[model samples]
Target: MTEISDWRKRIERYRFQGSECVKCGARYYPSRIKCIKCGSEEMRDVELPRRGRVVSYTVIYNPPKKFSKYAPYAVALIELVDGTRVLGQLTDVDFDKIRVGMEVEATFRKLYEYGEDGHIVYGTKFRPVVS
Candidate 1:
Protein backbone atom coordinates (compact mmCIF):
# COMPACT_ATOMS: atom_id res chain seq x y z
CA MET A 1 0.00 0.00 0.00
CA THR A 2 1.04 3.55 -0.59
CA GLU A 3 1.91 5.92 2.20
CA ILE A 4 -1.51 7.57 2.14
CA SER A 5 -3.29 4.23 2.20
CA ASP A 6 -1.11 3.03 5.05
CA TRP A 7 -1.72 6.23 6.97
CA ARG A 8 -5.43 6.04 6.38
CA LYS A 9 -5.62 2.36 7.25
CA ARG A 10 -3.13 2.35 10.11
CA ILE A 11 -3.05 5.69 11.87
CA GLU A 12 -6.78 6.29 11.50
CA ARG A 13 -7.80 2.94 12.96
CA TYR A 14 -9.15 4.22 16.25
CA ARG A 15 -12.62 5.02 14.82
CA PHE A 16 -14.46 4.79 11.55
CA GLN A 17 -16.96 7.30 10.22
CA GLY A 18 -18.16 8.34 6.82
CA SER A 19 -20.08 11.27 5.52
CA GLU A 20 -23.80 11.10 5.06
CA CYS A 21 -25.09 12.63 1.92
CA VAL A 22 -26.51 16.03 2.82
CA LYS A 23 -28.96 15.45 0.00
CA CYS A 24 -30.13 11.94 0.87
CA GLY A 25 -28.69 11.10 4.28
CA ALA A 26 -26.96 7.76 3.85
CA ARG A 27 -24.30 5.97 5.90
CA TYR A 28 -20.95 4.68 4.69
CA TYR A 29 -18.04 2.67 6.00
CA PRO A 30 -14.31 2.79 5.24
CA SER A 31 -15.33 6.17 3.92
CA ARG A 32 -15.66 7.20 0.32
CA ILE A 33 -15.37 10.37 -1.64
CA LYS A 34 -18.79 9.78 -3.13
CA CYS A 35 -21.99 8.84 -1.38
CA ILE A 36 -23.03 5.43 -2.69
CA LYS A 37 -26.69 5.96 -1.89
CA CYS A 38 -27.15 9.21 -3.77
CA GLY A 39 -23.99 9.34 -5.87
CA SER A 40 -22.95 12.66 -4.42
CA GLU A 41 -19.25 13.27 -4.69
CA GLU A 42 -19.35 15.99 -2.10
CA MET A 43 -19.02 14.56 1.37
CA ARG A 44 -17.36 15.17 4.69
CA ASP A 45 -15.29 13.08 7.10
CA VAL A 46 -16.81 12.22 10.46
CA GLU A 47 -15.06 10.63 13.42
CA LEU A 48 -17.06 7.97 15.18
CA PRO A 49 -16.93 7.20 18.89
CA ARG A 50 -14.38 4.82 20.32
CA ARG A 51 -16.64 2.62 22.39
CA GLY A 52 -19.15 0.02 21.20
CA ARG A 53 -21.04 -3.11 22.15
CA VAL A 54 -20.87 -6.44 20.44
CA VAL A 55 -24.09 -7.16 18.60
CA SER A 56 -22.96 -10.39 17.02
CA TYR A 57 -19.80 -12.51 16.85
CA THR A 58 -18.09 -15.70 15.79
CA VAL A 59 -14.94 -17.56 16.77
CA ILE A 60 -12.66 -18.47 13.93
CA TYR A 61 -11.41 -21.91 14.71
CA ASN A 62 -9.69 -22.09 11.37
CA PRO A 63 -8.42 -18.75 10.32
CA PRO A 64 -6.95 -17.73 7.00
CA LYS A 65 -3.55 -19.09 6.06
CA LYS A 66 -1.81 -15.93 7.13
CA PHE A 67 -3.73 -15.77 10.42
CA SER A 68 -3.63 -19.48 11.19
CA LYS A 69 -1.35 -18.93 14.14
CA TYR A 70 -4.03 -16.81 15.70
CA ALA A 71 -6.77 -19.33 15.18
CA PRO A 72 -9.71 -19.72 17.52
CA TYR A 73 -9.91 -15.97 17.74
CA ALA A 74 -13.08 -14.01 18.18
CA VAL A 75 -14.42 -11.58 15.64
CA ALA A 76 -17.45 -9.43 16.23
CA LEU A 77 -19.86 -7.00 14.75
CA ILE A 78 -19.91 -4.08 17.12
CA GLU A 79 -22.30 -1.18 17.19
CA LEU A 80 -20.64 2.03 18.18
CA VAL A 81 -22.18 4.80 20.26
CA ASP A 82 -23.03 6.61 17.04
CA GLY A 83 -25.05 3.60 15.84
CA THR A 84 -22.55 2.58 13.20
CA ARG A 85 -21.93 -1.14 13.04
CA VAL A 86 -18.47 -2.49 12.21
CA LEU A 87 -16.74 -5.88 12.11
CA GLY A 88 -13.42 -6.35 13.85
CA GLN A 89 -11.40 -8.82 15.89
CA LEU A 90 -11.67 -9.01 19.67
CA THR A 91 -8.29 -8.65 21.32
CA ASP A 92 -6.39 -9.32 24.57
CA VAL A 93 -9.09 -11.55 26.05
CA ASP A 94 -10.28 -15.07 26.08
CA PHE A 95 -12.55 -15.83 23.15
CA ASP A 96 -14.95 -17.86 25.30
CA LYS A 97 -15.71 -14.87 27.50
CA ILE A 98 -16.96 -12.72 24.62
CA ARG A 99 -20.70 -12.29 24.28
CA VAL A 100 -23.29 -10.09 22.71
CA GLY A 101 -23.68 -6.67 24.29
CA MET A 102 -20.19 -6.80 25.76
CA GLU A 103 -18.69 -3.35 25.73
CA VAL A 104 -15.43 -2.88 23.79
CA GLU A 105 -13.06 -0.13 22.87
CA ALA A 106 -11.11 0.61 19.71
CA THR A 107 -7.39 -0.11 19.83
CA PHE A 108 -4.52 -0.46 17.39
CA ARG A 109 -2.33 -3.55 17.33
CA LYS A 110 -0.08 -5.55 15.07
CA LEU A 111 -2.05 -7.53 12.52
CA TYR A 112 0.58 -9.26 10.39
CA GLU A 113 4.10 -9.31 9.07
CA TYR A 114 5.13 -8.33 5.57
CA GLY A 115 8.55 -9.80 5.03
CA GLU A 116 11.99 -10.42 6.54
CA ASP A 117 12.72 -6.69 6.47
CA GLY A 118 10.80 -6.31 9.73
CA HIS A 119 7.99 -4.35 8.09
CA ILE A 120 5.01 -4.80 10.36
CA VAL A 121 1.36 -4.05 9.64
CA TYR A 122 -0.94 -2.59 12.24
CA GLY A 123 -4.70 -2.14 12.33
CA THR A 124 -7.60 -1.41 14.62
CA LYS A 125 -9.10 -4.02 16.88
CA PHE A 126 -11.58 -4.07 19.76
CA ARG A 127 -11.01 -4.99 23.38
CA PRO A 128 -12.92 -4.97 26.63
CA VAL A 129 -12.74 -1.39 27.85
CA VAL A 130 -12.22 -1.56 31.55
CA SER A 131 -13.93 1.16 33.48
Candidate 2:
Protein backbone atom coordinates (compact mmCIF):
# COMPACT_ATOMS: atom_id res chain seq x y z
CA MET A 1 0.00 0.00 0.00
CA THR A 2 1.10 3.52 -0.63
CA GLU A 3 2.17 5.71 2.24
CA ILE A 4 -0.91 7.91 2.05
CA SER A 5 -3.34 5.02 2.04
CA ASP A 6 -1.44 3.25 4.77
CA TRP A 7 -1.46 6.34 6.92
CA ARG A 8 -5.22 6.69 6.45
CA LYS A 9 -5.75 3.14 7.64
CA ARG A 10 -3.54 3.35 10.71
CA ILE A 11 -6.49 3.73 13.05
CA GLU A 12 -8.29 0.58 11.94
CA ARG A 13 -5.09 -1.38 11.53
CA TYR A 14 -3.71 -0.36 14.89
CA ARG A 15 -6.85 -0.19 17.01
CA PHE A 16 -9.52 -2.22 15.21
CA GLN A 17 -11.66 0.84 14.77
CA GLY A 18 -15.01 0.00 13.20
CA SER A 19 -18.14 1.81 12.24
CA GLU A 20 -21.52 1.42 13.89
CA CYS A 21 -24.74 2.45 12.28
CA VAL A 22 -26.65 4.94 14.36
CA LYS A 23 -29.99 3.81 12.95
CA CYS A 24 -29.75 0.06 13.49
CA GLY A 25 -26.76 -0.44 15.74
CA ALA A 26 -25.03 -2.64 13.21
CA ARG A 27 -21.26 -2.74 13.26
CA TYR A 28 -18.62 -3.27 10.59
CA TYR A 29 -14.87 -3.58 10.54
CA PRO A 30 -12.63 -1.62 8.13
CA SER A 31 -15.16 1.09 8.82
CA ARG A 32 -17.86 1.79 6.23
CA ILE A 33 -19.07 4.99 4.65
CA LYS A 34 -22.63 3.67 4.41
CA CYS A 35 -24.45 1.22 6.62
CA ILE A 36 -25.30 -1.91 4.67
CA LYS A 37 -28.15 -2.96 6.94
CA CYS A 38 -29.90 0.35 7.40
CA GLY A 39 -28.49 2.21 4.42
CA SER A 40 -27.86 5.11 6.72
CA GLU A 41 -24.99 7.47 6.20
CA GLU A 42 -25.06 8.24 9.89
CA MET A 43 -22.36 6.24 11.54
CA ARG A 44 -19.96 6.49 14.44
CA ASP A 45 -16.53 5.13 15.11
CA VAL A 46 -16.28 2.36 17.66
CA GLU A 47 -13.36 0.32 18.88
CA LEU A 48 -14.19 -3.33 18.47
CA PRO A 49 -13.99 -5.68 21.43
CA ARG A 50 -10.68 -7.50 21.46
CA ARG A 51 -11.85 -10.76 22.93
CA GLY A 52 -13.50 -13.34 20.73
CA ARG A 53 -13.92 -17.02 19.91
CA VAL A 54 -12.75 -18.95 16.91
CA VAL A 55 -15.69 -19.74 14.67
CA SER A 56 -13.75 -21.56 12.01
CA TYR A 57 -10.25 -21.61 10.51
CA THR A 58 -7.93 -23.04 7.91
CA VAL A 59 -4.19 -23.55 7.74
CA ILE A 60 -2.56 -21.96 4.74
CA TYR A 61 0.30 -24.11 3.63
CA ASN A 62 0.93 -22.19 0.42
CA PRO A 63 0.18 -18.54 0.67
CA PRO A 64 0.66 -15.67 -1.74
CA LYS A 65 4.06 -14.13 -2.34
CA LYS A 66 3.59 -11.42 0.23
CA PHE A 67 2.60 -13.88 2.93
CA SER A 68 4.76 -16.81 1.80
CA LYS A 69 7.12 -16.35 4.71
CA TYR A 70 4.31 -17.16 7.12
CA ALA A 71 3.02 -20.14 5.20
CA PRO A 72 1.44 -22.94 7.15
CA TYR A 73 -0.07 -20.37 9.44
CA ALA A 74 -3.63 -20.57 10.67
CA VAL A 75 -6.16 -17.99 9.62
CA ALA A 76 -9.38 -17.94 11.56
CA LEU A 77 -12.82 -16.51 11.25
CA ILE A 78 -13.25 -15.06 14.71
CA GLU A 79 -16.43 -13.73 16.22
CA LEU A 80 -15.55 -10.89 18.54
CA VAL A 81 -17.32 -10.36 21.84
CA ASP A 82 -19.69 -7.84 20.30
CA GLY A 83 -20.65 -10.20 17.45
CA THR A 84 -18.32 -8.50 15.00
CA ARG A 85 -16.54 -11.26 13.17
CA VAL A 86 -13.04 -10.69 11.83
CA LEU A 87 -10.47 -12.75 9.94
CA GLY A 88 -6.94 -12.62 11.24
CA GLN A 89 -3.83 -14.74 11.53
CA LEU A 90 -3.48 -16.89 14.60
CA THR A 91 -0.25 -16.49 16.48
CA ASP A 92 1.79 -17.97 19.34
CA VAL A 93 -0.09 -21.27 19.34
CA ASP A 94 0.10 -24.78 18.05
CA PHE A 95 -1.84 -25.66 14.89
CA ASP A 96 -3.00 -29.01 16.25
CA LYS A 97 -4.42 -27.36 19.34
CA ILE A 98 -6.64 -24.92 17.47
CA ARG A 99 -10.33 -25.63 17.71
CA VAL A 100 -13.68 -24.09 17.15
CA GLY A 101 -14.92 -22.05 20.08
CA MET A 102 -11.40 -21.44 21.33
CA GLU A 103 -11.10 -18.03 22.92
CA VAL A 104 -8.67 -15.51 21.44
CA GLU A 105 -7.65 -11.90 21.90
CA ALA A 106 -6.39 -9.24 19.53
CA THR A 107 -2.70 -8.48 19.44
CA PHE A 108 -0.71 -6.00 17.44
CA ARG A 109 2.14 -7.51 15.47
CA LYS A 110 4.25 -6.93 12.43
CA LEU A 111 2.47 -7.98 9.25
CA TYR A 112 5.15 -7.52 6.62
CA GLU A 113 7.55 -5.11 4.95
CA TYR A 114 7.50 -3.84 1.39
CA GLY A 115 8.85 -1.33 -1.07
CA GLU A 116 12.38 -0.20 -1.71
CA ASP A 117 12.43 1.34 1.74
CA GLY A 118 11.04 -1.87 3.28
CA HIS A 119 8.30 -0.06 5.12
CA ILE A 120 7.14 -2.35 7.91
CA VAL A 121 3.41 -2.87 8.11
CA TYR A 122 1.88 -3.65 11.44
CA GLY A 123 -1.62 -4.90 12.19
CA THR A 124 -3.75 -6.98 14.49
CA LYS A 125 -3.38 -10.70 14.88
CA PHE A 126 -5.09 -13.08 17.28
CA ARG A 127 -3.50 -15.19 19.94
CA PRO A 128 -4.98 -17.91 22.10
CA VAL A 129 -6.20 -16.47 25.36
CA VAL A 130 -4.49 -18.12 28.25
CA SER A 131 -6.58 -19.29 31.12
Candidate 3:
Protein backbone atom coordinates (compact mmCIF):
# COMPACT_ATOMS: atom_id res chain seq x y z
CA MET A 1 0.00 0.00 0.00
CA THR A 2 1.06 3.60 -0.48
CA GLU A 3 2.68 5.20 2.56
CA ILE A 4 1.51 8.63 1.43
CA SER A 5 -2.11 7.62 1.91
CA ASP A 6 -1.33 6.29 5.36
CA TRP A 7 0.31 9.57 6.32
CA ARG A 8 -2.72 11.47 5.10
CA LYS A 9 -5.00 9.32 7.28
CA ARG A 10 -2.84 9.64 10.40
CA ILE A 11 -5.03 12.36 11.85
CA GLU A 12 -8.16 10.21 11.77
CA ARG A 13 -6.70 6.73 11.69
CA TYR A 14 -6.45 6.30 15.44
CA ARG A 15 -9.81 7.78 16.15
CA PHE A 16 -13.40 6.97 15.25
CA GLN A 17 -13.58 9.71 12.68
CA GLY A 18 -16.57 9.27 10.37
CA SER A 19 -18.99 11.35 8.40
CA GLU A 20 -22.60 12.04 9.25
CA CYS A 21 -25.24 13.08 6.79
CA VAL A 22 -26.98 16.20 7.97
CA LYS A 23 -29.84 15.55 5.61
CA CYS A 24 -30.89 12.08 6.82
CA GLY A 25 -28.91 11.80 10.05
CA ALA A 26 -27.16 8.78 8.62
CA ARG A 27 -23.57 7.96 9.52
CA TYR A 28 -20.66 6.08 7.99
CA TYR A 29 -17.14 5.04 8.81
CA PRO A 30 -14.13 5.16 6.50
CA SER A 31 -15.65 8.54 6.03
CA ARG A 32 -17.39 9.24 2.76
CA ILE A 33 -17.60 12.59 1.05
CA LYS A 34 -21.19 12.01 0.01
CA CYS A 35 -23.99 10.31 1.87
CA ILE A 36 -24.37 6.84 0.44
CA LYS A 37 -27.83 6.44 1.93
CA CYS A 38 -29.38 9.79 1.05
CA GLY A 39 -27.13 10.94 -1.76
CA SER A 40 -26.61 14.21 0.06
CA GLU A 41 -23.52 16.34 -0.31
CA GLU A 42 -24.13 17.90 3.09
CA MET A 43 -22.09 15.98 5.58
CA ARG A 44 -20.20 16.69 8.78
CA ASP A 45 -17.40 15.02 10.67
CA VAL A 46 -18.31 13.01 13.73
CA GLU A 47 -16.21 11.18 16.29
CA LEU A 48 -17.94 7.92 17.10
CA PRO A 49 -18.12 6.58 20.61
CA ARG A 50 -15.27 4.39 21.72
CA ARG A 51 -17.45 1.65 23.15
CA GLY A 52 -19.40 -0.74 20.94
CA ARG A 53 -20.78 -4.24 20.63
CA VAL A 54 -19.48 -6.95 18.42
CA VAL A 55 -21.91 -7.70 15.64
CA SER A 56 -19.85 -10.33 13.89
CA TYR A 57 -16.30 -11.68 13.74
CA THR A 58 -14.00 -14.30 12.35
CA VAL A 59 -10.75 -15.84 13.54
CA ILE A 60 -7.97 -15.76 11.00
CA TYR A 61 -5.72 -18.74 11.23
CA ASN A 62 -3.95 -17.58 8.12
CA PRO A 63 -3.24 -13.91 7.82
CA PRO A 64 -1.56 -11.67 5.30
CA LYS A 65 2.24 -11.45 5.07
CA LYS A 66 2.48 -8.39 7.28
CA PHE A 67 0.14 -9.90 9.88
CA SER A 68 1.43 -13.46 9.83
CA LYS A 69 2.99 -13.04 13.25
CA TYR A 70 -0.39 -12.06 14.59
CA ALA A 71 -2.16 -15.01 13.07
CA PRO A 72 -4.99 -16.77 14.86
CA TYR A 73 -6.31 -13.35 15.62
CA ALA A 74 -9.89 -12.13 15.62
CA VAL A 75 -11.35 -9.40 13.46
CA ALA A 76 -14.73 -8.06 14.48
CA LEU A 77 -17.46 -5.98 12.98
CA ILE A 78 -18.36 -3.64 15.81
CA GLU A 79 -21.45 -1.51 16.05
CA LEU A 80 -20.90 1.79 17.82
CA VAL A 81 -23.41 3.33 20.19
CA ASP A 82 -24.65 5.53 17.38
CA GLY A 83 -25.19 2.43 15.19
CA THR A 84 -22.20 2.89 12.92
CA ARG A 85 -20.43 -0.39 12.31
CA VAL A 86 -16.75 -0.75 11.36
CA LEU A 87 -14.20 -3.51 11.12
CA GLY A 88 -11.32 -3.67 13.61
CA GLN A 89 -8.91 -6.25 14.86
CA LEU A 90 -9.93 -7.46 18.25
CA THR A 91 -7.16 -7.62 20.85
CA ASP A 92 -6.30 -7.70 24.55
CA VAL A 93 -8.86 -10.46 25.12
CA ASP A 94 -8.74 -14.19 24.75
CA PHE A 95 -9.59 -15.22 21.21
CA ASP A 96 -12.00 -17.91 22.38
CA LYS A 97 -13.92 -15.46 24.51
CA ILE A 98 -14.65 -13.12 21.64
CA ARG A 99 -18.26 -13.52 20.69
CA VAL A 100 -21.13 -11.69 19.11
CA GLY A 101 -22.72 -9.04 21.34
CA MET A 102 -19.58 -8.66 23.43
CA GLU A 103 -18.88 -5.09 24.40
CA VAL A 104 -15.64 -3.59 23.13
CA GLU A 105 -13.74 -0.33 23.03
CA ALA A 106 -11.42 1.33 20.57
CA THR A 107 -7.70 1.13 21.24
CA PHE A 108 -4.72 2.71 19.54
CA ARG A 109 -1.92 0.30 18.78
CA LYS A 110 0.70 -0.56 16.17
CA LEU A 111 -0.86 -2.31 13.17
CA TYR A 112 2.26 -3.28 11.31
CA GLU A 113 5.31 -2.13 9.38
CA TYR A 114 4.68 -1.45 5.72
CA GLY A 115 5.95 0.07 2.51
CA GLU A 116 9.57 0.67 1.52
CA ASP A 117 9.79 3.38 4.14
CA GLY A 118 8.96 0.76 6.81
CA HIS A 119 6.26 2.82 8.41
CA ILE A 120 5.33 1.41 11.79
CA VAL A 121 1.67 2.02 11.16
CA TYR A 122 -0.40 2.85 14.23
CA GLY A 123 -4.17 2.69 14.23
CA THR A 124 -7.24 1.66 16.18
CA LYS A 125 -7.74 -1.87 17.33
CA PHE A 126 -10.47 -3.06 19.70
CA ARG A 127 -10.49 -4.73 23.08
CA PRO A 128 -13.30 -6.12 25.13
CA VAL A 129 -14.87 -3.59 27.43
CA VAL A 130 -14.87 -5.47 30.69
CA SER A 131 -18.29 -4.83 32.05
Candidate 4:
Protein backbone atom coordinates (compact mmCIF):
# COMPACT_ATOMS: atom_id res chain seq x y z
CA MET A 1 0.00 0.00 0.00
CA THR A 2 1.04 3.56 -0.61
CA GLU A 3 2.13 5.63 2.34
CA ILE A 4 -0.79 8.03 2.11
CA SER A 5 -3.46 5.32 1.87
CA ASP A 6 -1.84 3.41 4.68
CA TRP A 7 -2.12 6.51 6.84
CA ARG A 8 -5.75 6.94 5.81
CA LYS A 9 -6.67 3.34 6.62
CA ARG A 10 -4.82 3.48 9.90
CA ILE A 11 -6.95 6.32 11.15
CA GLU A 12 -10.18 4.60 10.15
CA ARG A 13 -9.22 1.37 11.87
CA TYR A 14 -7.93 3.08 14.99
CA ARG A 15 -11.11 5.12 15.31
CA PHE A 16 -13.55 2.42 14.14
CA GLN A 17 -14.96 4.71 11.52
CA GLY A 18 -17.12 3.42 8.67
CA SER A 19 -19.61 4.79 6.22
CA GLU A 20 -23.36 5.04 6.43
CA CYS A 21 -25.49 5.97 3.49
CA VAL A 22 -27.82 8.75 4.48
CA LYS A 23 -30.34 7.85 1.84
CA CYS A 24 -30.76 4.16 2.63
CA GLY A 25 -29.10 3.73 6.03
CA ALA A 26 -26.62 1.20 4.65
CA ARG A 27 -23.23 1.01 6.25
CA TYR A 28 -19.71 0.00 5.13
CA TYR A 29 -16.27 -0.43 6.59
CA PRO A 30 -13.08 1.28 5.35
CA SER A 31 -15.71 3.69 4.04
CA ARG A 32 -16.82 4.27 0.45
CA ILE A 33 -17.20 7.16 -1.94
CA LYS A 34 -20.72 6.10 -2.92
CA CYS A 35 -23.31 3.81 -1.36
CA ILE A 36 -23.19 0.39 -2.96
CA LYS A 37 -26.72 -0.48 -1.91
CA CYS A 38 -28.59 2.64 -2.91
CA GLY A 39 -26.32 4.19 -5.51
CA SER A 40 -26.46 7.40 -3.53
CA GLU A 41 -23.57 9.75 -2.92
CA GLU A 42 -25.02 11.06 0.34
CA MET A 43 -22.74 9.25 2.71
CA ARG A 44 -22.10 10.03 6.34
CA ASP A 45 -19.28 8.98 8.57
CA VAL A 46 -20.20 6.52 11.31
CA GLU A 47 -18.25 5.21 14.21
CA LEU A 48 -18.77 1.47 14.48
CA PRO A 49 -19.82 -0.31 17.63
CA ARG A 50 -16.79 -1.24 19.64
CA ARG A 51 -18.31 -4.52 20.68
CA GLY A 52 -19.09 -7.56 18.57
CA ARG A 53 -19.35 -11.33 18.66
CA VAL A 54 -17.10 -13.85 16.98
CA VAL A 55 -19.04 -15.22 14.07
CA SER A 56 -16.14 -17.23 12.70
CA TYR A 57 -12.41 -17.57 13.13
CA THR A 58 -9.26 -19.34 12.06
CA VAL A 59 -5.95 -20.09 13.68
CA ILE A 60 -3.05 -18.83 11.62
CA TYR A 61 0.09 -20.82 12.13
CA ASN A 62 2.23 -18.92 9.65
CA PRO A 63 1.90 -15.18 9.39
CA PRO A 64 3.60 -12.77 7.06
CA LYS A 65 7.10 -11.40 7.66
CA LYS A 66 6.26 -8.39 9.80
CA PHE A 67 3.62 -10.38 11.70
CA SER A 68 5.53 -13.69 11.97
CA LYS A 69 6.32 -13.00 15.59
CA TYR A 70 2.62 -12.95 16.30
CA ALA A 71 1.88 -16.11 14.37
CA PRO A 72 -0.30 -18.90 15.69
CA TYR A 73 -2.82 -16.28 16.62
CA ALA A 74 -6.54 -16.27 15.96
CA VAL A 75 -8.06 -14.04 13.32
CA ALA A 76 -11.77 -13.67 13.74
CA LEU A 77 -14.72 -12.29 11.87
CA ILE A 78 -16.80 -10.44 14.39
CA GLU A 79 -20.36 -9.47 13.71
CA LEU A 80 -21.03 -6.03 15.05
CA VAL A 81 -24.35 -4.92 16.51
CA ASP A 82 -25.20 -2.84 13.45
CA GLY A 83 -24.78 -5.90 11.17
CA THR A 84 -21.30 -5.21 9.85
CA ARG A 85 -18.64 -7.87 10.22
CA VAL A 86 -15.02 -6.94 10.90
CA LEU A 87 -11.83 -8.98 10.84
CA GLY A 88 -9.31 -8.37 13.58
CA GLN A 89 -6.68 -10.24 15.50
CA LEU A 90 -7.82 -11.70 18.79
CA THR A 91 -5.53 -11.03 21.71
CA ASP A 92 -5.11 -11.05 25.51
CA VAL A 93 -6.73 -14.49 25.76
CA ASP A 94 -5.71 -18.09 25.33
CA PHE A 95 -6.19 -19.61 21.90
CA ASP A 96 -7.84 -22.65 23.44
CA LYS A 97 -10.60 -20.44 24.81
CA ILE A 98 -11.46 -18.89 21.46
CA ARG A 99 -14.61 -20.13 19.81
CA VAL A 100 -17.61 -19.14 17.82
CA GLY A 101 -20.00 -16.72 19.47
CA MET A 102 -17.33 -15.51 21.83
CA GLU A 103 -18.08 -11.97 22.89
CA VAL A 104 -15.26 -9.51 22.31
CA GLU A 105 -14.54 -5.82 22.39
CA ALA A 106 -12.10 -3.76 20.36
CA THR A 107 -8.86 -2.64 21.94
CA PHE A 108 -6.01 -0.73 20.44
CA ARG A 109 -2.60 -2.40 20.48
CA LYS A 110 0.77 -2.16 18.80
CA LEU A 111 0.73 -3.77 15.38
CA TYR A 112 4.25 -3.07 14.24
CA GLU A 113 6.99 -0.48 13.92
CA TYR A 114 8.47 1.18 10.91
CA GLY A 115 12.22 1.54 10.31
CA GLU A 116 14.30 2.32 13.39
CA ASP A 117 13.23 5.60 14.95
CA GLY A 118 10.18 5.59 12.71
CA HIS A 119 6.55 5.48 13.80
CA ILE A 120 5.08 2.61 15.75
CA VAL A 121 1.76 1.65 14.25
CA TYR A 122 -1.23 0.85 16.42
CA GLY A 123 -4.52 -0.75 15.42
CA THR A 124 -7.53 -2.54 16.82
CA LYS A 125 -7.34 -5.99 18.35
CA PHE A 126 -10.21 -7.81 20.02
CA ARG A 127 -10.36 -9.47 23.39
CA PRO A 128 -13.07 -11.18 25.38
CA VAL A 129 -15.30 -8.55 26.94
CA VAL A 130 -14.82 -9.06 30.63
CA SER A 131 -18.13 -9.18 32.40
Quick one: best TM-score, which candidate? Answer: 2
Residue-level lDDT tens digits of model 2 in 1-131:
58788888988989978899999989998889999998999999999999999999999998888788778899999999989988999999999999999999999998777778878888899999999
RMSD of every candidate to native, in Å, equals 2.7, 1.0, 1.3, 1.7
Candidate 3 per-residue lDDT over residues 1-131, each given as its tens digit: 67888888876777768788999988887888999898999999888789999999999998988888778888999999888889989999888788899999999999889657777889889999876
Where model 1 places Cα greater than 4 Å from the true spot, the runs are 1-8, 14-27
Candidates in order have lDDT scores of 0.76, 0.91, 0.87, 0.85
Per-residue lDDT of candidate 4, residues 11-115 (tens digit): 777887889999999888778999988899999899889899999999899777766776888899999878888888899989989989999998988766655
Candidate 1 has an lDDT of: 0.76
Clash statistics: count for each candidate: 0, 0, 0, 0
- The parts of candidate 4 lying over 4 Å away from their true place are 116-118
Question: What TM-score fits each model?
Answer: 0.79, 0.95, 0.93, 0.89
lDDT for 103 in candidate 1 is 96
* Winner of 2 and 3 under TM-score: 2
Q: Candidate 2 regions off by >4 Å?
A: none
Query: Candidate 3: which stretches are off by over 4 Å?
Result: none
The lDDT leader among the candidates is: 2
lDDT at 100 for candidate 1? 92
Between 3 and 4, whose lDDT is larger? Answer: 3
